[model samples]
Target: MPGYHSFTANIIYNLAQLGIPIRDSEFFDIQTYLEIVEIHKNVYAGETPSRQATQADIDTFLG
Candidate 1:
């Protein structure tokens, strides 16, 4: 089964597709992680497993 790191890998991969470069360390940093979680919640809404993020979501997070 896919675990936490795999999940985070998915996040990183998707973000990179949007030209939003992110470091592995940033995912563990409280501030950056919280921002990512917030943007994630907003993007996925009620989706349980959290879908792969889109460029629009990344743009929103960038703003």
Candidate 2:
């Protein structure tokens, strides 16, 4: 986890704050759901532009 940012961790924390359920699984379904929710939250935060990263951006970084 050396290079990992806290983005996903923060999403999980926020989900907990909103009374959403979380569970650990081999497929990580809950974490995936929360990540999308977090992205939407950032996108619709009422700004002139959105800072939510695109899938291509993520793909570039992943590559």
What CA root-mean-square deviation does each model show from the true structure? 11.0, 14.4
Q: Over the full model, what C-alpha lDDT does candidate 2 score relative to the true structure?
A: 0.68
Q: How close is candidate 1 to the true structure, as a TM-score?
A: 0.32
lDDT of each: 0.70, 0.68
Best by TM-score: 1
Clashes within 3 Å, all models in order: 0, 0
Where is model 2 more than 4 Å wrong at Cα? 1-3, 24-63
What TM-score does candidate 2 reach? 0.30
lDDT of candidate 1 over 1-63, digit per residue (tens): 659899878777766654466755454665775586678658776667857999999999999
Deviation (Å) of 24 in candidate 1: 12
Please give, for residues 1-63, the per-residue lDDT of candidate 2 as tens digits.
853568667756766765566653234576676686777778667667757999998999999
**CA shift of 59, model 1, Å:** 37
Alpha carbon lDDT at 41, candidate 2: 77
